[model samples]
Target: MFLLSQAQMAKNGKTSPRPRNNVVYQDGCFFIVDFLRFSVPQTTLCSLCPGEEFVRLTITMAATGPAHSTAADSTSASIAPSAVVAKPCHNCRRRRLRCDRSLPSCQKCIKKGEKCLGYGKLLVWNRGVASRGKMMGKSFHVPDQAAASTAASGNQELCLPRKYRFVPSNMPDGEAEAEAEAEASGDEGETSVSINPCLVDPLFQDLDRASRFYISHFTDQMCRDLITYDVPRHNPYRGIVPLIRDHALLLHVIVANSAIHISNVISKGSGLLNGVPGQYPQHDALMAKQKTLQLLNQAMNDIDAVDPEVVLTAILLSINYELVSSGKDDWKVHVEGAQKLIDYFGLSKRSDLSSAMSALRDHVVSDCLIYYILGSTFSARQPNMGSMTSRYPFLDVLPLLERAEANSYMSCPAFLLQIMLSASHLSNLDVITGFEEEQAGYLMERARTFNIDAWAASVQGISSHNDFESRVHVASAHKSAVCLYIHQAVPSANLMDDDNRKRIVEDIIGHLSFILPGNLLLKGTSWPTFIAGAESRDPAQRAWIVARLNDLWEMLPWGYVHTAIEMLKAVWAMEDTAAETTGGWLKKLKGLGNDWIVV
Candidate 1:
């Protein structure tokens, strides 16, 4: 918290020879002064300086001797037994000004006939005090009722109150009540104080309580330094491959989430100002946001330097959040960043070795998820900004899927569904344009790397009642439909004759119809908005719209059965009508299964 100005602390207020013993190098304005021990106020100000006053600078070059001491180690008088009963400043309480710790009665408190509150002790960190002038003492313990209520509240405001200012008037009564309950429960002492006490305040409570002592003493900038510069620079995880494998990705996720939270707070300025009844500083939130970004950037560099997996995860996380937040502008950059790792490690080609690396599966899964996210984003309509990137057709996505299939252990249904949807958007006439013998041979070679027979065999092991296998089959069929559509879109493509293309589309529709029954309909459909908003007030309609998903599954040996069912469901629910528009999907779901039990 110290802002040092060595030049100003000197005799001539010039940056010159360092001041020697007995000289008090004090120039900056002092806000809070925490002496090593208790004593009277001892702030020194240079008479010549006016604007320089109030700066929280340290006396870096103050001279010292036996009688005089370095400011860093200036000792305080021992607290007598009677000093335990600290008094509050009457004037500060009456005026609602935060009081500087003074003796039995502070100057303002005495003048105002107010109680002078003495701080028990300052909360220190590591082995030192956090801020200068903070009283060091043991913190008061709260009762069980208070602790349980606070824990049950779920909101961090109960614990981190200082970080927020409660705008009770704007907030609902229940929320304000919870905050009040949390504070009242924590405050065991029934003292008649003028204003609410921050001592028992959950926000400024000791770091030791939370075991966050490491960064407790740190200012916003110092926290930036400790994690961004110090922690990574130390290479704490260097050579610990197992630890990195087990926890590194998770740790990085926490860091990214924390940074996002900080950025949200700063950008929104939601809880930074409120019911405190005075002007509070907003600069800290802004600074904390900047520092968090810097930390994120640093963490990203560290992950990239040490491991490719972490980098891939970070990129995917950024993409995931962007998709959630509708931050489409930065989508491609993140995608390219992920693509770099896939290229670097040659992860596009699945390795055949029996003993693979520890995170091999994870790396494959991450890529699959990334592709799925991007593909979904491409298909989902923008809120108001129109379509995002659609120039790349379903044909172009096949290579990416083929690459993912080669790398992944299982034929993930979600990824396959993405490809299928993309395919459905195109025509079926281009299926055979590029079916050269060599390229066709490549497909067969890669397909051998797949274990379709084993996958099918594994499906029978599950109970007949279970639909996991059916779901996977349906999803894979959907993917096949996508491939068929892509083939038809190419001018020269023709995997199937004109009649066969029609058959493929019909087969896809059949498959869609099979799964539109009972719970399975809602379970499998790829309609984003409806599925995403299923938890809303009306969910029964989703089931009503498609009540024959199981029948569609039985009908479609080819592939279009599923597509047909989807079209039927769309028509049944009125989701396909021009008047319905794209936004009516959720409403349709609500209206679908209003009567019969979807089970």
Candidate 2:
């Protein structure tokens, strides 16, 4: 047997030269032939020597391993070899071999005839290399995954965060998910109108912050003005935040309203109108309103594609926008639009009142009634629904009035609707001439005979209940105002003496204090205050009414409030100059062509 060092064999040209200081040599009567030089296969090299020689060579090779590459040694210098480094498979680590660290398996194990141990401590790149564009030589577009998903699904409005998604109270989880998926895929045969991407993208980009702002304002501030009664179930703005996220148009309306509200608050605090700071820009709000109007027109034109909730919310928000910002009578157009939607849905005809009338419908109808009544009160024309009894024969106004007299919150609005209906008819009477004047006399007689004292007495029982107090106070105040309206409409009638009329006006002024200045119920007392202010003969009472009007203007800043205040001021000026009655003030107001509707 002959032993050859790798260097000696290489010098003799028997082996190819390499760093082989650690290579092993065994006993062999061997021909000093290199496998690479002689073209001998590796498998045959062991057989060329005897079995004992091969076994001895294997033992020697195990003792003195092959030389390590400088690259691997330097790269792994930071980590101890036995420290169980991550990223490499267990098999590769155990064999002290390099690992490619590919997922599932590595290449080192397969080449070495060993089973591949799976990867260890997988590390994910959250912000991929593409996000660090500076590291790359050229810029590449990493498309927004959310935008792409919304585009593919064709439901840009549905890309809200989970926290903002409002699941309806009645919707099942499975059905809701199915519906969402269907909506995302546009499977309901709904009309697909492509809104301007510019109008939608920026809103969605800041949706989280915008949603929080609007929802906070709605719950804390807006609800105070919206829900005057204790009928929580019938309040339309309840649980409307999530709905705002579901529809783009509704979201715009809410944001627009929120912008106006923020502006008002800032204006009140700083006494600066243009420099008010807020997340929603004033221009954005104005643009949103314009967009909302455009979308509303489209929805109205495409009747089949109109979403009832969207239309209803849009109309309500538009009305509020007009009240907060424009303070114009453009809100009447929205009221009429809401009426068209209500009629389209046949909400009044549905048999199951609870199931058929959603909170949105209740809000729409109530708002329409309030606006229609106010508009008819001052306008020269009358509404088509002449009387509550004639318009809704099924709805018994007598029971509703009795229930209201019992201080039932649910019945108060219905009762008020009845009063407004009758007032609407009597308001149009040509009392200057004798045209249908007897009908006015009959309405005045009914109003005088109505037991308002009983209703006021019923509120006394519930006045102690904190939850019910505000609503009761507002109801009583509105009832007093209605009585004052009846007197003002037919002051010449002998149903009540001059003393009784003065007592009614004093009662209205007294009731107005309960919901004046800071109270949310003050929103519903504007018209009543106007009526009482016009009739107030005493300087102290007239000053108090004017102060309340000023407070309302300071808080809401609506144009109508300003108009009402101006009209009241003119009436007060006339009364100071001469003893002007409520009818005389009305005549002066009519002569000025100022058909002021205060509510």
Candidate 3:
């Protein structure tokens, strides 16, 4: 199978201006370049054959030109012998649109009357629109304050400006990644290389060769992405790799999630949409999820027959699948399932890792609480879902969470997490009974005034100016957001002054600027960004929100952030057309349903 990709080709210390007929190899990837600007041969559409090796690591290059072979045009043949099969072009991939793969440009762009950026070049529109949102684009001028803050943060140089977004990021520094991006002001377009080889791993035996692609993808790529603040060689997921040797159930969970993750990345990064077809072997995400459920059922039927940790991990992975697969209404259902297992297994109370168990549970307590609280921000599947309630109360388990446990997953300080959880619990109580103005005031004061300097002083290993600045910015962002949540949730507290609210919004946006998109901290900012986005009134500010969320989408490559972007646009639309009907984010979020876990 051939792939469509591009790289910044450098020759004699200058970026190449035209395509040349030759083959170039760098890193572990190979590119076939030619002068066939258009008139690509009609390749036979060979649909994925059912359940074969899926993929084998054998790449043979057959050169093609004006006199290559007449037999190449035969339709009955599997694929044109000389044509390299193509993936989506740059424009098609960015817009998540189907490309006809016609040479110099895609027919899809021609039909849409838009410029087709070639397979490899990174380009943009003057005033581009998002693939999913109906919101129209206007010329966006970045706020001076925001631009200055972004420049101060040091990621301004790495920024790849976009007229529109929901674009993916390329961050590979001695780690597992598929794509690499580079740019130089005058004369610095280096010969960038990407080592994206989808070869099977021997560690993943006893599965279809194609299925192993997803398994390997998870272990090598997504697993590291989960740990936002740091990349440790012995990161928790790697600890679980050897466990797959004896447990067939765990492998199914990995495949289900990984395929769905790939699917999410392609489909405009939206869980509400379907995975774009033919990028990889035909592994239906939904079907894989169903198979996972069946395996889970069989394991559940035999009491104490399956390791509880495995069962819990499987349940959590299902929750993950729901997050990327439609923002599925079952988000809370799986969280609830995890709760039941935690109750039965006492995982909430258990902190001892002295004994060997599945590596899945290592950092789960903090992760579970993070998802539980953050999920409450946008869940609209049910009505009056203001209170972040779980059957067992993920909040109460927070005190028991060790700093290492909390730090292992999320990037913010543990103290701030507790404050956010406590504030959410107050919101929950307001929904249950009457609002307690005094209690909410106390929480908001602490949330808004917590000293980041003091907090940093108390913590260990927070070295480097960049890392410290990222933590401080993210901590303050969360502070502003949680305060806004309290103001919305407990209106009786009288913190809803319009000027104060807008100031908080500005602060939240500014903090976001300090935290670069590629920094792990950006992954944690979506909740705050969405909270601020729904409350924002200016179109330009809203445009900035879209750009940052787009950066976020590039980093995480999950539907959760895309879902936030869409939801924010919906809120903006409501305000623009019917100003009186807007009820801030909490009311609008509850209207969306209580099941969305956009983490």
Which one wins by lDDT: 1 or 3? 3
The residue-by-residue lDDT of candidate 2 on 1-599, one tens digit each, is 23434544444555543323333222312322221211222222333223323211111111222111111112222222222223578777777877776433455566677776555354545443343544432232333676566567654332323223233223457966975675558754432322223223443455654454555555556654555443444444655655655677887787678667766666556443333344334555686788888888888888887667567767877887776764444666776676667667754343344442444455555565566557666654443442332533225323423322332222244455465556556555665345434555665555545554555456656343343555556666666666666655555543456687688788877766776576645666787788888877888988888888888766565557777777788877876787545555555555554445666
Q: What C-alpha lDDT do the candidate models reach, one value each?
A: 0.36, 0.55, 0.58
How do the predictions measure up, each by TM-score?
0.34, 0.56, 0.60
RMSD in angstroms, candidate 1?
22.9
Between candidates 1 and 2, the one scoring higher on TM-score is 2
Per-residue lDDT of candidate 3, residues 61-148 (tens digit): 3443232212211121222223432666677787787767654455677668887665554655635344235434422344456655
Model 3 segments beyond 4 Å from truth? 1-202, 267-282, 355-360, 381-396, 399-409, 425-435, 458-466, 579-583
- The C-alpha stretches of model 2 lying farther than 4 A from their native spots are 1-216, 229-235, 270-275, 278-281, 351-357, 383-413, 431-435, 448-473, 491-498, 514-520, 551-560, 574-583
How should the candidates be ordered by TM-score, best one leading? 3, 2, 1
Best by TM-score: 3
For model 2, where is the 10-residue window of minimal lDDT?
54-63
Q: Against the correct fold, how does model 2 do in TM-score?
A: 0.56
